[model samples]
Target: MVSVSRYGREMGSVFDLLGTHEPALTAALGWALGRSPELMSRFLNRLGLNGSSDVSDVAVQLETADEAGRTDIELFTSTAHVIIEAKQGWIVPGEVQLTAYAPRLDAAATSGLDTRLVTLSDSTAAWAHEVLPAEVSGVAVIHWSWDDVRDLIAEARSKVRGTERLWLDQLEDYMGAATSKRPVTDALAYCVVISNDLFGDATFRDYVVNQRVYFHPVTGGGWPTVPPNFLAFRWDNAVRQVNRVVDYEIVAHLSERFPSVADDHSAGSRPPGDAHVVYRLGPDIPLPDGGIPSGKQNLRAQRFWVLLDQLLTQPTVIEAREATKELGAT
Candidate 1:
């Protein structure tokens, strides 16, 4: 009954009408994988199928029926043929279904193609790997979870641009919602870079230290669709204040909050009628002596999320960033 409004239309999604519908979700992923070679490569590599050649002229087939059963998705590249059996829940594909797909894979292998059968399910990778046989009828079987695909898309984002980037974003959003899997963005803390001019200004520091609120324009693509719980203020080569985000709202202008302050620039250059995201914060937690140093690494001006524990425990920003690589690895 729920839906995500995207591309200007309200349509059923995997979280709603298609929640347990295998073909629809399978087709959605197949479409994106067929279009983006980088995504395909990353996905195969994540499954430890690194020996397979890069995707070239890949084709995706959905619900192709044979005597045994209907396959959820079928992928073909010049050098390989991959059969995917997708399930919305943790259940493994029945022997009947596996038997249906194995021979087709064997025929492809006989034709001098790298044949593989992949199971995309809601179960943990460890469970699927343990129960599912490594090979079926001479073709390799790889187990993967929706969570794994979501993370792969997040990683592949850096390797793509333009339409490919947009496709990956949409795919990631859908998969995250469908599986009720919160992306890494939700697990981390958001860090904002305070400009030098504002960092040195007493009024700005006072408002943050005393008043305890931080805000930024909600117009940029840099902001996350879902906000994180903690916020860190970075300036003067260190993270000075780290606070829990109590609430956030969009306001029309600076005068709405600070009516008496004559300098409007303190709240930032608020274009008339523009909305900003104002984050209400709790008391700042004391950081280690000298605060968390930025060290030699140059962080971009845009806001980014960092593992909260890493940001607090690691001595330098670069080290904290390095620690974040281990996030979700387990």
Candidate 2:
């Protein structure tokens, strides 16, 4: 005999109810875009939409086709025609999907009008930007992640008041949860060390010594080295503050033996000079306000790690060009 379960009947979230229906999601987003100028500004900014224009004139869910293929959202002004294709979850919209909308955009384009294609998804739609036929469509393709939208809503929430503020607050909360649950690729884990005397320094200095000693170990053994991507901070004991923050690229990891200067340096019967891990760091890039506060250091790191990682991952476009020229010289 099978017993029927009766506990799973509750209605889920508003977004959950919307499910995979792109049209419905488009409508919900369009409504938000219609009401919030700040949201519209950010959305347009992500598409690389430039110059001074009336965001109030922006329209959404404009019917560019009647027979099953229509652009999801369109913002048309005197200067530009921006089309957005939005997707929910990890289900990516393919190039074929975008190409279908090209003819409509082509027909809509007028002389001197800047046409652009944009793909919005819960996760980074980098593939869409890569595959979309920008040359054929005669439009630039840009991808905006839901995280970008959340940031806009957060910005809007700060400046709005009364009913608008309340609605934006709710929307921001919803998007925050939605984006948080989306599966991330190359997700990073962070560990921060906060101490009154990280390097026994109370003031900013050019460099600091990090010492490591080992006991009952092989002669070749040494302290574990930090990754090139790791960050280190100096906390001041007297002021109960963080004096500096440094972003280091581990150029070299060197070790050598040092004679024991004090009894504390020795381990049991073993004399000093066991091992050392010298982390040669890169130049310092000081964060605002001297350094991140000890109380809020973790939060600050968590917030900026992604952006910092992207910077560290590759050289800038200008840098790349310079490197290419230097390579040719060799």
Candidate 3:
């Protein structure tokens, strides 16, 4: 009998083993999509398409022309036809690449069929959102991140059983691992500035002084190196008495940008660099009731050094945010 362990040893997954054979991945996705109507509905919803939960028919890698091109994954019914273009990793298809498939998609949308085009990526494609809508002639273009797909599968898992459920679980695990590996070089760190009347907001300054937290921004390039899922904080020049060195693992990467309304105390926007990654702070190190211990010596880097040393010994700190939560709950 064919077993997963035997195959997994040679390749990270059956999907990886298939490599550039888009047809195989298409077939796999098609099967999964058909089996889970909720998955199909959520997918269609992301593409801004209206569809019933019931999926009637699905096709894989349909070739429209020998050398021309093919649709990666096609879902069809009496009313709708969705042409999906999927990317595995960092490679993003340009408007020209997607434009090539427009003809095939248009031709398929006959007999009053509502046509939609979708591009799937492992991460958000800001450029695709900007370009694909205008470039693809007749069809409506939408983008879906791998995380969106994984969430759909996870939601559908509860409704499946037997080997189907096992397969869904495995696919979710594979996608999670693959997407997490995407490198994030630049991030916007949110910190608290504890200085006297810096921004002329006396009320805000009082709050910061009381809570012992202030809002500060740090760029990835400014630091020696930014380890993934970590927040590195720097104090403003005005703040002479505060921790000079401290960092915490980022928990939730919030969609909100830095220098937000609350950041009026901050000098300006994050320094020019790559895209600014935003995050919510993780758990802070246990502090005394008085906070950070009093005195000029308390501001030394050694204080933070000792805290980080202890944090590094914890396995949860090294893992992803979700995994860290699971460890804590146990």
Candidate 4:
């Protein structure tokens, strides 16, 4: 019951897998927070530690060990020392495990540094409220979900540009996908029409279409986070082929899916090593006659959905969409 994005990656895809792993999630969050002062500030503020200064030299460490065992993440700045205990899925941190880390915070406080212990899990903050004492060994406790971290990164993304923005974008998407936790449902009886002019390209016709596989990057354009059941391919002002989705996979690179023909530039320009979601489509269910035309309006590379039956009965794309909407209302 994996959830898949229609034009992009599916649930439990490579990206989501990377995110679900506790250590990877910790490393990613630590990396972004340490590099971006703005993001770090927002994070501290959310923990009720405001006006934090002299944080320019924040250092992040993972799996730091002491007599109390290893903490998941540790952040050391000029004015603050923070220890994070992160757990993935539905697991909750035990009170004994949390209390063991309290000594480190209290020790840091002796040096006149602001000290706190933060617990991160998939559960809501109420778990933190109930499990955590009023204070752990005199060190304040803070709770946060993966979603809170995602929102902070998203909010900070708008304020910066260039590489900073790029890092946040990757982190935000990863966290969002991981926290979605959507339960799988039955495939809908819907069709997504995709406009592609690659039919004129012989390599695409021979290798891609003939192979019945379609791949696209997860980023750089508009794509769904959840895949629909059917896909309709439109070209030369008409949609002639409608295929049911058989299976899909998310790969870190295109070569993983098509090694023999990876170098061929026929199926449009897909740079190697870029994350892509590839769909295995069923045999073409060709439309009748000259296929469904676009009528007077020009629909160029536009992705839209219509009821499956509308594609077989309607003569034009506009009429198909209108009829699909009408049926939906009834």
User: In terms of lDDT, which candidate is strongest?
Assistant: 1
Model 1, position 105: C-alpha lDDT score: 82
- Model 4 global lDDT (CA atoms, 0 to 1): 0.67
Model 3 weakest 10-residue run by lDDT: 246-255
Task: Give me candidate 1's TM-score against the actual structure.
Answer: 0.49
Predicted candidate 1 versus true structure: per-residue lDDT over 1-330, tens digit per residue: 565554443544433344425666787788788777889888766655576546776677888987877898887777778888987645556556676789888767888987878887655554466457888777777887777787788888988899888778777766754452444445477787765444223455565667788766545555643344788888787888898877765455544665543244443554523445567889878898778988787775656678888888888876887787656411
Determine which window of 10 residues in candidate 4 has minimal summed lDDT. Answer: 180-189
Clashing pairs in 3: 191-216, 192-214, 192-215, 193-214, 193-215
How much is the lDDT of residue 45 in candidate 1? 66
Candidate 1: minimum summed lDDT over ten consecutive residues — where?
Answer: 11-20
> Which scores higher on TM-score, 1 or 3?
3
What's each prediction's TM-score?
Answer: 0.49, 0.46, 0.50, 0.50
lDDT of each residue in 1-330, candidate 4, tens digit only: 757653343544334545456778787787788777778888877766674644567788888998889998888877788899887643447778989888878767999988888877654454356556656778887777666777788788979998778778777766654443323332223333443334323344343367787666644666644444677776678776777877665566566666754555543665656666677888877677887887788777677677767767777877887887776521
lDDT against the true structure, each candidate = 0.69, 0.46, 0.47, 0.67
lDDT of 2 by residue, 184-250 (tens): 3212212233332212122112233222111122223332222213333434411111112222111
Candidate 4 residue spans exceeding 4 A from truth: 1-19, 183-330
* TM-score of structure candidate 3: 0.50
Off by over 4 Å in 1: 1-20, 47-53, 180-330
The list of candidate 2 runs beyond 4 A from truth reads 1-21, 62-64, 123-130, 133-136, 176-330
